[model samples]
Target chain A: MNLRDFRNFTIRDYQDLFAKGELVPRELLTIFLERIREVDSLLHAFLFVNEDRAFARAQKLEEEGRDRSVCPPLWGIPIAIKDNICTLGIPTTCASRILEGYIPPYNATVIERLEAAGAIILGKTNMDEFAMGSSTENSAYGPTRNPFDLERVPGGSSGGSAAALASLEAPLALGSDTGGSVRQPAAFCGIVGLRPTYGRVSRYGLVSFASSLDQIGPMARTVEDTITLFEIISGRDERDSTCAPYPPFSRAEIPQEEEVRKMIIGLPREYFSEGVDSRIVGTIEEVLKGLEKEGLTIREVSLPHTSYALEAYYIVAPSEASSNLARYDGVLYGLREGGEGTLQDMYFRTRTSGFGAEVKRRILLGTYSLSSGYYDAYYLKGMKVRTLVRQDFERAFQECHLLITPVSPVFPFFLGERTKNPYEMYLADVFTIPSAMAGIPALSLNCGYVDNLPVGLQIIAGPFQEGVLFGLALFLEQMLSLPLPLPEIGQQRRS
Target chain B: MPGHVSLEEVRKIAQLAKLSFSEEELTRFFQDISDIIAHFEKLNELDLEDVSPTSHISWSQPPMNPDEPVDWQGSDLVLKHAPCAAGRYFIVPKVVEKEEKLS
Candidate 1:
């Protein structure tokens, strides 16, 4: 098989590629390097690419793992880390000017897990500044263009990771989701992305966006591949007190009920809102019909307080962001002042010169919202609404097993479409945030395409129910047969 | 009523947040803050007298493990991209200094 076939092979298919003696890790690394050289001008998905380092690692893996039980799970498996996540040797710019040359001295917990599994680290992928915007347009490095349409966005914060996976530039990648960063981008880029129950993956080295809300999750071409990667990286680490101890079902224990009568799905009415695109809604309805034809039960349930999730999220997220981001002063970390001035002058120059306008806007809003005098009214009040949102899901789960919704309101829009209107752009996350707010496992998988562009169906379950979530995602794959292709915009330049 | 915040209060908060803006930008920020609080005011109408307020969803403060200082002390070559280091520690200029406020 040549490089085209090499790029297309999933992690599962690679074992055979290795067994056949026709392809090896070094050759695969060269293919990805060559592909990036061709297509990355249009994609702009990566902040850095390390061909020599990646090739060296792959060569070491081939030499060491050749004949020993010392075989590593991801030995030579290529992975791209979202820029916000730190690697000891590589820069960890959160795609903001403040951290233009900043690098962490240690690996994030997720990166440690990936390297332990022997995955090859290719380079840093672009993301929204401090995991902030919905379009990735907020990156100081510039936005990552969707491989499906170079003129469109890859759907942000995690957009670079999603695009890299979609274009087969990497078999697996890492991204962080505070609200919908992981799922929405994966949906737009047409790949499978999992936002595990908050804290399922450790945030030990993740630069804090919202301390309570930030989570690291996996993006992949297939659901089983996502599960496989999630399993390898998940477990309680003493380093992260927030990490939850839970596991998705392994490949060996995948359930096949022998018939259709055993399956059940719940469609919450709040998810089918007024402004959602009719085509996106129609695609999900078609999937529901197909599931029904297979003998599964479908019920329309009410998450009575669903409308309040987004409102609550904006307040709480910014409030926490306001506090967590205060650490990036000119003194301790990140960009510093270059000229002689007062301490105050140094700080003023450093911050004003450092952070982007959107990030500055959030910090100001958040700090004000959480200040002593307003805490009870705004910050504390938003938390009350947050509880009601979680209880609404808990109450709904009592009635149904799985909840479904469109991952975003519409398909991928042109890159600069709604960025000038941040409010309108924030709306893309409305459907996906409540689950994150409630700390539940959610998955986004392609359901159908509109104008040949992909739309995703999200599967959500109660906290720690990732096994159920993965099962539903795999089941949807078995049931949907349309040609929902990966991001194909850069294919001409890729080979 | 947003009795806790005013235009002057927004300026103070922006200073704490480390963002410097012109007088015009400050006015715009105050207006937006007022609008957001006005929307949040709708929640105050609810009779939530007996409801409990939540601080966090699933967070537990990290338990302190063995308290030995793990050595970050390395030029270590691992932190090659960070430009601000002196020996084993990350170096930064001093933070607070006496200042005069404008009258």
Candidate 2:
């Protein structure tokens, strides 16, 4: 198959070809690598591409040969990984100068699982430095542009993974969502992303941002593909104490249309409030109306504490970050500066030079909040407010099986538009934060497009209810059936 | 709560964070952090007196794994990435001054 045909092929399509002996893994890898060579200069989505390793893996898979019945799932599949997840011997920079050239000696549990399933690692995709920002613009290397429009951001810090999938660089990718990193970017890039329930996946080798909030989620072009990847990487891990004591997700059959019609979806009133763009609200409402027409109930519910979620998140996330990021002390690994000075000076200089502006800002904010005098007032209070936020979701779930909202408040903004204003960037995640704070499963799927930019409809379910979440997503994916053509890149610039 | 984050506070926070900033950057951080803190004060408006803080979402305690020692094969590889190392020990600038005597 040619490049165009390759761009349209999903994981299943490639598997079908492999089964028919019409394609080899190495041939597919070459096509994707060639596309990356031609397109990545414009997108800057990858920090490092494992070309040699990928080819070796693909050739090995070819030699092993595909067995129709016994071959592992995801065999010969090329997948992109967000830079934060550790892959042994590969540089996991988290798109920060601090970790430049620091190759991990161990693989994250997800990486081990993916490789065990016969998936090939494409490379490490770019992200905000330490996953702090909502835009990839904060990346120390560079930003990953939106596939739909080169001038706009592919909402971040998982922007690269989303952009790669949207641009057809890879069919499956992994991203860590501390806040809206995965879902917002997925929405902006017109792909599928999920933030599974906390503890649903192991966090053993994934770099920590916020201990309570960070989760490695799967991203793909379709909900089914996303589900396939999610099942592979999720389940209990002894290494991660936080991982729930549950088996890997069993493939629950997607509920039939009749059963789906019986389920009720709640629309949080706060998500559709004044701050959200009217176009986005309208686009999601139209989808809700269509669902309503299909004999599904769409009830308006209240998440009163939603207004305080962003504030609490800013406090809790940064506080955890300041504590988690203290390991970079110019000694063990990563960049070091001013070696001849005192240990304190070496630490100060290394951190000051290695960290970018946003990272330092968060570190300082967290330090101040967790410092002796302010802990109760800031960090403690933030946690209390988080409880309120979770309660709001619990109450809403009592009235409905699922909740739907816009993934982001507005369309993907142009590059450098919100870079100067940190608060403005924080507002972009307003819709995704409440669900994240509650630690529930949330998925972003393309529901419609406005002004030529894709609008995402977010479906949130109670903890461990990812099966239900995927069912709704699959139903909507069929209903919308929006043809996601390969983006024309530079050709579609706004005149 | 408004305009309460002073330059001294920003400096202290930076020091505690082990990060440094120029005079100009310090001024900018003061303004930015003050604005952000002011926004955070909005949370105080709600009465959360009875609500317990949620440090983690799951209420169940994590089950512990057996405490067993296992050989780690990556020791050499781990030390290889260190900026300064001497025989498995990471080298660093002196922590204690020469005049300070050990207790």
Candidate 3:
């Protein structure tokens, strides 16, 4: 099967292929790895690939001869990791020069869990340095092009994870969603992407961006694949104080037919503002109509504070990032350039020279926002607004089962096109940031296409309401006929 | 009615963040920080006399468990990644007197 057809196969299907001994895990993994080798120079989806180690894991699993019911959920499944998540003995650079060649001695808590559940690490995927930008172009390794259109960017900082799944480089991929990093790229790539509720998944090992906003989730080609990976990773961990206890995720079945029409979907007016692409709004209307035909009721709701979320996010994220990134002082876990003079100069030189332009830009912004005189004026005020944003979601969900919106105002833009202006890049995150500010979960699925590129419909649910999100996304998948066609690679080849 | 964030304050923020800047870059940073601060001055005009500052999106309930000192153990296997050392002591840059450095 081609990469397109292969990604459509569920993790269960691939495992069954392995169970019947029809296709060996090593052979299946190599098929995708070879595709990555042949195509990734143009796509730049992966930062590294550990073929030998991945093969070894496959060999061990094969000898064990355990089916998924007895084995782990991820047994023999190849998965892509966002570059920021630390993997033991693998470079966890966060796509920044400051952390060049750095290797972790232990996996991040989520990484440890995924491996224990039977995933084969395909290597780190590209991302915005420090998960700061909306476009993968901010990565020091270079930008990841959208699989659909070569010159266009894969949405960031989880861009590569999304691109890897889109390209069929892996059946499943792991990415962190701070704002829209997971959902936006999943939208642009026409894949099933979920951002689990905050604390639903542990974050002890994921590199800090905005501690309050950050979460790791899965990207795959279908709703079921995303659900399978989520069930495996969601749980509390002692190492992360933020992780909360979850209901047994194994019982998280797709909402049944009897419960189907009971869903209350809300359309927030603030989400479909003047700037949103009309065509996307129209596509969402059609989805709502189709769902209504199937017995789901739709209501128009208001989240007045939604407008301020993007601005509030900029202040709060940078404020936390400014503090969290302090450890990368060319001291621990980064590129350290040895220099003469006091220890201060060594830190000064290493950070100044090592970090790229976008990372430096963010660190500066974050530092100022959290600085002495400005803390309350900027950072504290942002936090107040953040509360309002969260309250907005809480109020809307009071009237509905889920909130639907465009994942992004516009579709993916050409790489280097948006990089020259950072504010423009920030605006792309407007629709996605509200969920992050509120610590709610949102998923992006291909609803329809405009001008041949895919447009994603975002389904948002209140905290710990992933069940609602999965139900609606799966229902839409069966009801909506506009399956996003594969990226037209030939007509849109990258430079 | 307002405190100006001077060019020097902006530069100090960069220094605290471990970012060394050229003279020209420092001047530009000063300008950018000033412009951003000016734009953010809208908050002070809000007449927020009684609003409490919120730090997280979620309400801060008292944590389910109280913080207590624990006798945690560590192995050199993990500690080897620490940046500074003289035996077990983390030898940080001496920014203050030894008395002040006691954490």
Candidate 4:
């Protein structure tokens, strides 16, 4: 096997070559490191690249002369991790100045599983500060530009991971999705991202945003690779109480094609409301017609409380964020600023200077919502709306096997377009936020292109229903069969 | 826009969040935050008095792990990330200073 462009290689491609003795782990690692050095400066995808560690790991694996047949599934394949997920001995900055030099003493459980599967940790990618913003512009390290169009923003907070994959910096990546962080970025970059059911992937090491909504899952160039990583990282962990007790997920668990084809796809009418771009709706409608022609049924469904999802999400996420982020008070970990007199003064100054604008905005919003006079009105009301949102999904699923919607209402916008308008940024998450509130499994696949930018079609399933989600994604992957070409970083126009 | 939050309220909220902002920033935040809260007011249109708030969607009681102690190997490593640490303890400014002598 002659590997021409290593960036084009998928997990299976690399595995096949390794098993055939035509390729080795060390050579693959070298290619990626070289690729990162060449392209990453333009993308700003990675915050820290562990050149020495990755090379050493690869050399060690090669020296072992390990039998490929008996090794872990991801043996020798390199994967990037979002900066928020902790990596032992590596700084997990969450793209914030507060954690500039902070390093984790232990790895997140998902990291442990990835290592056990023999996947190489390439490096940590940039994100919205503490995963608070729609675009990665909020990142303290500066924004990760879209590889497809240098002038536009890559939908974030997982923008770096998606950009990395789009640029062929890494074959696979892991990112946390709290209200479309993973899926939105994936859509913008023309890759695949899955947010497993909450508790499906252990959250033990993920830095919390909103504890209830945060979930870490896989991002890759293909459905097969996403499922492969998902199956490996999923399962219960003692450290995270919220981790579900479900048995380990596997390839054998996916529903058969016939069963998947028989499934009814629901198009939530609320998701197709007025502000959504006509081009996006046009693309989704075309895909729906194709799916119907393929013997699958499509039906109009109503998720009545959908309009309130954003409101509820804003309240709950920031409320929890305000509570969770209170831990970074110049005490145990992260940055510390001096106080003139009191410990409280240190906390005030440290947090004020350390956090970025979006982060501070959310913190204030959260703190106000959960504060004494407003808790009952804002936070509690948001919680009730959350219940209504979940109920809406519950009712919708009763009529259909799964739900399909646009990942974002519009295509990737130009960088700085929505930076000044916070409301506009929040609206980007409208369609994806409901499923997140419901704590269901959702996957984004590159369905079509609006102009030169790729448009993603999201498929959401009931809790612990990743198997069905994967099956539907696989069917769509085969049916669409669209060639996803790598984006030229310099080009910012229609292809 | 019915209930406009004043600058004083914004200050109180910032204080609650352990954050401090410049006067100009506070003014801008007040407007931005008010607009956001006005959007959130859409929730008041629905009658959800009977609805039980859901903190999480899962109904299953999480299975608790055995209460046995496990060895922790990262104490020193964790301390290494602290901005100021004396041995394993994190150092902070004095919270309670000597009472000022009566002037």
Candidate 5:
């Protein structure tokens, strides 16, 4: 098949072809690998491509398909995994120098499930070092540029996974959302990203950022494809103590006309604050209008603690990071920098040389917040504020079924615009953080475009309400009916 | 921000965190950390006296699994990535030299 045909096909489309024996898995894998080789150089989306292994798996699955009565859920589908998620023998670098050559000893639960579903593991995608930054610019390997306009960034630290989907390097990708990592990048790339309620997905193999807020989510070109992958990868794993020990996620049937008419979408006033770009506000209003016309109720709600979310997140996330990253002391696995002194010297030099600037900056910030004298004043206080943030959602949800807002304050910014200003970069996550702080599920989908950059509308549901999110997202998607197309890669270079 | 962390305090933090930076780098970090701290200070404006901290967001804890050791099928894979390993144990620099005195 040609590039356009391959890009346009969704997971279901490929599955139908596979079931009919119309398309060969090995040939499709070859096409995808060839396309990735052609365009990945410009996109910088992947950190490691498991070409030989992926091809082998595709061939094996193809051979087994002849004997099977029913096709597996993700049969023949190639999926990209964020580098932070372990993949047994595959290199799982968090786009950091410290874990440059670290190969995971066991597959993440999600990887095992995908393999069981007969999915081909395409490669590991790039991300911000240690998932510490908003833009993929913090990636030690290099930034994953926006395929639409090369000068701009693909919002991150899940930027590479989103870019991989948008660039057609993979039909589906997995990424961890600590704060707005998954949603924001999905927004910027004009695709669907679902951050399941924290604990909905097993975190056994996903590296921790802020353990409480981190969730492994799926990024895909369409809502159905995203939900399909979400169902396969989500469940309780004994290895992750915090993973909810609930039954396998069973999505409720799509909402009927009466159900759709009864749905109430809360518009949090704090999300449309002055910091939001006028164009984005206009796009949101247009969507609200569309929702209203569809007979859904739209009401204004207040999330009083919205302004303090970024502050609370910076403190909470970094504080958790400092403790989590202490394991990379250069002894067990990953890079080890040796010197001429004691064991202390080796540790000091190893971390110093191994970490990038952004990683170090967060480490210092976290260490300071959790230090002996300041723990109460900083880390504890941040947690209290986090409670207030969650309470805001609880109160707001009392009056509405789901909250609707812009995924980011503005459309994706040009690369380097906010790099020098850490606080400004943090603000890019303002709209999405409150829901994440509440441990609720939220999904981002393309609503419209601003100056050729995609603007995403985020629909949030209370904890474990991913079913509602999917139905509503599909509803909004059909209402908007915006033309989704692959990026004309390698054309623009304004940067 | 009500607090100002001096370079000595930052150095102590680095030591606690098992990290080190040059003098110039420490100075830069001092300022950056201060700026971040200042930004985080906005959280102090809220009255959280009645609010309890949420360490984890799970609604209810799941029952614990039985404690049983699983065979280490991953020993070789884990050892494969180690920078320095002898047998199954990771090797590291000497903690105490023969002639050097403890600090």
Candidate 6:
């Protein structure tokens, strides 16, 4: 096939080609590597490309041969992994200088599952330092640019993975979302991303950011491709105490038209508040109107606690982050500083030098919140407000099967716009943080484009109700029929 | 209970967190963190006296595993990443110092 066809191919299409004996795993790997080489310079999507290991795995898969009945679901598929998730012998830096040159000795449970399912790892993608920033600009290495507009950010923490999929460097990728890490970037890059239920996926290998809110999710170009990867990565693992005792998710069938027609969709009024850009509101309304004509019931719902979610998230996330990052002292792995001085001096020097500006800010904020005198007023209050956020979703779901909202307040913003203002960066996550606080599953898909930039529509469901999300996303995908077009960078290279 | 944060408080927090910063950095961080905390003060507006805190959101009981220790085969691999390691043990700066006896 030609370059144009490769850019549009999904996991299912590749699987069909392999089954028909028309393509081999190694050949596909070469095509992906070539595309990455051509465009990665401009996008900066990947931090490391596992060229040798990927070729070896592809060769082994070729030698074993593709036996459709016996082969794993993701057989011969190449996928990108965010830098925060551990992969044995691969550098998992989380885009921070503290983890510079650090290699993991063990694979994260998700990595093990993906490898077992016959997926090949392309390499680790860049992310915000310790996953703290909403934009990828916080990364010490560099920020990943949006594929659609070279000057705009690719939405972040998972920005690298989203940009890679949108540019067709990889068909599938894994990203960890705490707050809007997965969905926001997916919305900005114009691809599909899902933040599974808090315990739906194991967290043994993901670098701890905010333990209560962190979850591994899947990102791809289409809804079905996302489901395939999500089913493989999600399940129970005894290693993580927080992981639920649920069975592995199975591939869900597309719901029939009648089943979808009977469902009621809720629009939380707080998600469409005045802060949201009028263009995004208009785009989502048009999509909702289309769904209404398709026989689905649309109703207004109130989630009163929505305004408090951002404030609570900022406090809670940093507090947990401060505690989780305490392991980075000079005694163990990672960077060491002030070795000639006393132990206390070493710790002070190492942490101060190792972390970036934003990371340091978060660590300091967390330390202040969890300090002895202020614990009750800051940290405790944040958790209590978390309960109110959870209650809001619990009450909303009682009336509707699922909630639909805009993924981000604005479109993919230009780089350096919000970098200097920490509060503005935090505000970008207002729409997605409520579901994260509630520990529910949420999905982001492109609804339409405003001024040539994509608008993301978020679908949220009750705990373990990912099937509902997939069903609605599939229906909306069919209705929108917006194919993954070649991003501007790719188009420029072609010309 | 006070909303205003002093630079002295920022220094104390830095000490507690085991991190040291330059004077310029301390001043900037003091300003930024005070702004963030001032914004977080909005949480106090909600009267959550009757609401209990949610530490975890999962509905399932945390599965209990047997308290068994298993041998790890990757000890060498783990030590390979340590910044200061001698064989299997990690090296650290001296934590104690000699002092003259009290007279």
Candidate 2 lDDT over A1-495, as tens digits, reads 867886556678888999998889899888889889989999989999999999999999888888888878899999999999999999999998889999999999999999999999999999999998888999999888998899999999999999999988887899999999999999999999999999999999999999999999999988889989988999999999999988888677457778888999998888888888899999988998889888899999999999899999999999999999999888888999965669999999999999999998898888888988788889999999999999999999999999999999889999999988788889888988988999999999999888779999899999988888888898899888887647876777769
- Off by more than 4 A, model 6: A252-254, A490-495, B100-103
Best by TM-score: 2
Q: Which candidate is the best by DockQ?
A: 6
User: lDDT per residue, candidate 4, A57-87, as tens digits?
Assistant: 8888888866755879899888999999999
Interface RMSD over true interface Cα atoms for each candidate = 3.1, 1.4, 3.6, 1.4, 1.3, 1.0
lDDT of 1: 0.79
Better candidate number, 1 or 4, judged by TM-score: 4
| Interface RMSD for candidate 1 relative to the native interface | 3.1
DockQ of 2: 0.75
**Docking quality level of the chain pair in candidate 2:** medium
Collision count of model 5: 0
**How well does each candidate superpose onto the true structure, as a TM-score?**
0.93, 0.98, 0.92, 0.97, 0.97, 0.97
TM-score, predicted candidate 2 vs. hidden true structure: 0.98
Off by over 4 Å in 1: A6-8, A67-70, A245-254, A257-261, A484-487, A490-495, B3-6, B28-38, B59-103
Clashing pairs in 2: none
* Residue A325 lDDT (model 1): 79
Give the per-residue lDDT digits (tens) of candidate 3, residues A1-495. 456656357888887777787887788888888888878888898998978888999888788876656778788888888888988878788998888777777788878878888888988999988888888888888889888888788898899988888777777889999988999988888887888887888888799988989999888888888888888888767677777754435645567765868888899998888898888888888888888888988999999877677767878887888788777765554666665555687778888888877677667878877777667777878888877777778899899989888999987888778765566788888888988888888999999877777889999998877887888887788787555345545467635
> Could you tell me which residue pairs clash in candidate 6?
none
Docking class of 5: medium
lDDT of 1 at A318: 86
